[model samples]
Target chain A: MMSANTDFTLAVEELTVSFDGFKAVDNLNFYLDKNELHVVIGPNGAGKTTVLDLICGKTKSTSGSIKFMNKELTKLSEHEIVRAGVGRKFQTPSIYENLTVFENLEVSYPRGRGVFGSLMFKRDAEVENKILEIAKEIMLDHMLETEAALLSHGQKQWLEIGMLLIQDPQLLMLDEPVAGMSVKEREQTAELLNKISAGRSVLVIEHDMEFVAQIAHKVTVLHQGKILASGDMDTVQKDPKVIEVYLGH
Target chain B: MSFMYEKLLGGKNGTVGFVLLATLILVVFPLALDGFRLNLVAKYLTYAFPAISLVLLWGYGGTLSLGQGIFFGLGGYGMAMFLKLEASSPENTAIQSTPGIPDFMDWNQLTALPWFWEPFNSFTFTLLAILIIPSVFAYLIGVAMFKRRVGGVYFAIITQVVSLILTVLIVGQQGYTGGINGITDLRTLHGWDITSDFAKNLFYFITCFLLLAVILMSRFILTSKFGRLLLAMRDKEDRVRFSGYDVANFKIFIFCFSAMISAIGGAMFTLSVGFMSPSFVGIVPSIEMVIFAAVGGRLSLIGAVYGCLLINFGKTAFSESFPELWLFLMGGLFIAVVMFFPNGLAGLWEDHSHHIKKRLGFITSLFSKNDTAAVAPKLEGSN
Candidate 1:
């Protein structure tokens, strides 16, 4: 087993990704500490999500090393990276719309994930209890049997979070978790993020600075496929390069 | 009783439909139809196996394989090879130059039985081959394409090509596979005459029993968490992958399972019909199998069975009277089904069954307040 580095739960070094002739991410370095919530803020096409995709093995980095717990993640497949203790929720709420809330959580419960194992799996008391517990945490306890498509936009976002929680990953990466949510929903999501980040690390790509200020322990401002500024929200907001490249626009 | 009925048949209406279907096949058909017509029904029901497989693979998994007939043909050939060997006993083949070899081998100037065909001499090996060969073939295809994440129309096109290749291979290798005519004159199975009326009836019963078993097995899979995962994968494959499933493995398993079930149908086809032909192992029959599933309701297992029977019955009836119009009519049916009833007959039934059930319940309440008062509330609550 690769020992989990106490200082850094995740570390990326010299990451570069170029699609065709245009470089989406260039020479990027990022890190997240244990129990810390790190936010990546940038304009559209600033490669904020691409960096998360690189760490989670969703996009192939042209040149880089992403180490999750001191183990290189770029060499692994998306599913393997997930099993290695990194969870990702997409930019859009990617919950199973046709399935019930209970089923959505049940699928992402992270046990019996193989083909034959899944076929023979039974919902035991322990699994049921865990599902209910997560449902309560996501504030969907009463809607467990309701189809996810019927869920409000904010509820779908929470359900996706609940899905990632069931996997119990040490690192949770959420892309634009508060996008399209109402102000109240954003506040609740902020609280939910802070509550869930007690023991694990969180990496969020968010456009909502207010939500980021509420939850982000450290903020990295990206500009033109590079990290233009890195500091606390107040410090990054004051950084002249960040202001000119992102906030000024 | 209600729990078992719902579990097995899918719901209350499903249970009623199942009971009606069961009675029609087991009681009414035997009593009403003569031997000739009964045999024809048995032949048609043999198709339900492939149709049910399509429901599991294409309907649920969202992997459309157009080479189902390849598996079907492999199964048919497996059983036919065994029966052909039995019929071509040394005494029976004494007139041929190769007295112990099948007649086709003699006609093709082959002196010895092929080594591959030697295994078919054993009934156990033939049965196992019927289940295993097609699954192995399907496994290879599934792995090659799914591992690389090739799907959608590309997968469908490749499967169609595979069935075409199999047909050409069978036709070209006449000496080995009995060619265009196929392995015919399969008179017996272990010295028992399969052509006899009593044996035909027995095989028909066995076929129906096995078809029911397969249907139940399919229903069990479709209701399981595995089935839900399949639906999730169909909708958002990346989400399923990130949820820690090797997506290719699930596709492979379902593909192989579908192939095995389709093969069983092919085996039964050989036994009841006493022949196995390349015509059933090609692109045309494969697409026909898809149509059966589509018309029945790709998502409905019971619907697939009825779809196969209805289509086959129409084909037989139309071809007998209006042979020239059969092709055009089939084409029209395919288009109409796809355009108007995308979910097939089963979807149509489910659409209106709620209102039908409600009306029926109200009528029943008029007749007897106690039963409707008890049943009506439960039905409303479930919806």
Candidate 2:
């Protein structure tokens, strides 16, 4: 199912992913608009994270077409997909724990990606300022020199986000951005996501309905590898199928 | 000056450590040791190349190769071939059936120089072959393995097998490669007899200089951003890949780079030892080379040099007195270093560096009572 539309930032048409005989994501159709903050909500085993994996090219789709900015995504590898301006933060806080917070962010800086480029790369004023700016944005300015493993759970999540921000991708996809965070951290992350969404599209897979309601411009409910409902949060929450399968249960 | 010191030596204490090492190798060793001892030190320095390569490959890049000896052997053979050809000049080998060919070829009843031996007649081509051949092998292995996601223990095992294969091949192909004895009777390099004591002394100085230069180059890479990326990749491969880097390319480059460095050491080894042999191109020597890096601090380039020197010195002395016990002692040393000091000597130094600095300050204070800037904190804190 190919989408002829070029207006959408990300368009997935009839996406299906299967492991052995079981379908993880089946015939999924989704689209993300420019500068939109979209949240995916679902019950356990409903494939909310699978959709993200499919989008980020972490899982190969059995049958589908994923077009990111009018370019076919299924043909590209994971790193190529990332270079194509899609940044994904995993469910767990995946960060370089041994390195300092500053080093973690510096790794994701868009420049010096080439082998020789990295060799010649200097921590010049521009790079230093960018790292400091991102550190400040993530509220980690004071801890830039601290090792990442020492960061609190919430801080690690933010550090991973800061890593993504350093790259400044056109689209940011986060899986469970506030799963293990405290209430205060959740609130801070919501604010951070809102600020970041000003110039970029965000696709968040979140189970916390309260967190979703706080920052989501639109929400989609997935059930057993398909989009059960899609609309504004209020409308989708009230829908009978959405209530029966997800929120009500 | 401070920036340069910090960048080159790692930090203030690192500068002290670096200076101590430089003085020991460059100034102290040359002056204190006799010619024979000096030549022995040069031989030890040759092994340091493989150890230093491990600092980059296994220590920083987290790519462990168990077959560095293969690269070393290839490089040694490359140099040996040239030396053998030079020594077997038509005038020198006039008594043999093959007057222009290496004596080994004549001994094996070959009347003609083999096609492969033709290029080694030129010293320049041999030098190029030494640097490039092993790296090409490493590149192939790296691309084949890393691209397909074969790594960790599996990579180590494959490299070990490669060392075994090369050893067997060199031993089996006696006529072509000088067999198990290897390419011996290497007399001269471009008409200068390398076996001469004066030439040995000169080569010793050259080897020391090259080893020092390698340390500097390694230090430069370790301090660079690329080095940081290697650390990043070692910690989290997936994250680096997701950050838009072709991870295989980095692994391949590092493996090839390590091979080239090991090759340099191998060439140096042939020059100093005066022969190349299959005894060096096997699993045991390969594993021993890794131990040198491990004991010296696999993460520290300078430490690798010291490790190579210390272990070789120990092996020479220990084996002479108690040959059977030396093997057991070596095994014990490996286990102890692995278990007790995972980071090795450098790690040990780093752990107590503050105390060492304080002691240094205290010693200085005894000499000059007003030297409070260095010892004030310790003195006041103690009081």
Candidate 3:
């Protein structure tokens, strides 16, 4: 994995997102280096998800520039950003319950963004082989043909991660990837994230400090729509403001 | 192989069998019924057009359109005007004249046919009117509503109001609209001898074929990726919009498609029964279309067809057996279905089949050496 101190892969300058009259993410500035697994910790309503939403174009930043690999991201739509190699997993599993594990990957394939394109498109063997290979890596190869809804919650989370892997995105933003996972599943997910971060950047929004300490190379603490601290998990967890925010002081 | 089988047979062997049986019954129905009854069924099928429209709008698109009757009325009234003109010719003066001037001319009391009404006097013109008028209206309404981002109950209310306004305008201009009596005493439809048994059967067959074709088309659309996007839109409209899909365009396309379907049904209705009335295009009938779709299972294409058939069948049977109790029974049935089977009959069938499968599996497991122990380890591991 690339070192956290390497040159930035994603740079956000003065990013702000407001809903109604209240600002959800206010003038937040951050930069992520390539292959870095950055954990964003925030108390409830701290705008961690809002930041991810803005980055994925699910919510537009009011006035700011988001540069991904030096390319402007603010003008792109969510689907366009997805096609441009940015994958997102929602807090809730967004996988199609009726579709099989393999079919879920197929639906997110980058080639079918257009209506006419999808209608005429056929899945090539290369795409199929790649999906299977990724599923195997995620320990989901056996469940390829199983309906997504029938999968266990932890399995569903892994399957969603596998889907993002299939998309082959440069950056993957996952919201609460292991929120409902068991201890073993959380460890497995952390291992999977470590393996994935070898070739890509991963921004995980999580509240679990132990899980963050396990895999996060660097952590940023968000409070009331602003960054309170940024450093290694031990250092940030020990920060007075971070402790007070978590304890509702 | 299982996927292919499920896709072709609609998930189960029994479902395919039942569909085949239903198709056979419909094919043979016209032969058993008298001409009058066959004609009524044909008319009901025509009404199914608007119901199908409601299915597309409400079932798939998640837009409950209460203005389908407006489009239906447009087609019906358009055809009625032309038929009235043809029947009121100098050579046919012996036939009964309307109480006042023909309904189309009553509002203005024009001595000469309006430029717009002039073309409708021809069968070809009337046919064109049926297709164009409803489609144009749908396009305008769709553009206005969608561009403004008016949706949900707001959309439903707007559409309902549109139909309501049309009904009032038509009824208030009794001279031009035939008022409450509506256009009746129809005759030949483009010299087809509509009163003849052969023509009635032909119309019935045509209606059945149209219904089948539209159902098939709807199925084709609903199974495609566009259909998935539509469902995604229903579940997460904001997500779809953010995904860069032209949500407004999609709404307009679906709304217009539904209106066209409804208009065709209306034209068939007028042709078969030889009458066009304001009641056919009012809020009540529009609401009835939504009810049909709801009862049928709004998510399934086949459900729409089944719902139309079931509702119309009940209407016919109840009216004949106990006329006074018909409306009460229908209302009660609606309430019962809504309260007990929120997903409607399709969901009931699914739940029943799942239970049957569970029972069968349990029985099979009792005879086998390996059962609970084999599956339990994996279940525990997953947890």
Give each candidate's fraction of reference contacts reproduced. Answer: 0.76, 0.69, 0.16
Query: What lDDT is obtained when candidate 2 is compared to the true structure?
Result: 0.89
Q: Give the deviation of candidate 1 from the true structure as CA RMSD.
A: 4.4
Per-prediction TM-score to the true structure, in the order listed: 0.94, 0.94, 0.82
The best candidate by lDDT is: 1
lDDT of 2 at A114: 83
> Which candidate has the highest DockQ of all?
1
Candidate 1, residue A26: lDDT: 90
Stretches > 4 Å off in candidate 1: A1-6, B1-14, B357-383
lDDT of 3 by residue, B185-258 (tens): 66776665666788778877877777766665565455555666566677656545534455677778778878
Q: Could you give candidate 1's per-residue lDDT for residues A44-65 as a string of tens digits?
A: 9999888888888889999878
Instruction: Report lDDT per candidate.
Output: 0.90, 0.89, 0.77
Candidate 1 chain B least-lDDT 10 residues: B374-383
Report residue B233 deviation for candidate 3 (angstroms). Answer: 4.0
Q: For model 3, what TM-score does chain A reach?
A: 0.94
Which runs of model 2 end up more than 4 angstroms from their true locations?
B1-11, B355-383
lDDT of 2 by residue, B1-383 (tens): 75576566677666776778778888899899998888889889899999999999999999888999999899889999999988888999999987988877888988888899999889889999999999999999999999998999999999999999999998887888999989898888877889998988888878887777777677777777778889988988888888888888888988898898899999998999899999988999899889999999989888898889989999989999999999899889999999878888887767556556667776766664554465566545333
lDDT of 1 at B134: 95
Cα error of candidate 2 at position A72, Å: 0.8
Off by over 4 Å in 3: A1-9, A18-21, A69-85, A114-134, A163-166, A231-249, B1-22, B78-108, B118-136, B139-150, B173-186, B235-252, B320-324, B347-383
Models ranked on DockQ = 1, 2, 3
Give each prediction's DockQ, rounded to 2 decimals.
0.80, 0.73, 0.22
- By DockQ thresholds, what CAPRI class is model 3? incorrect
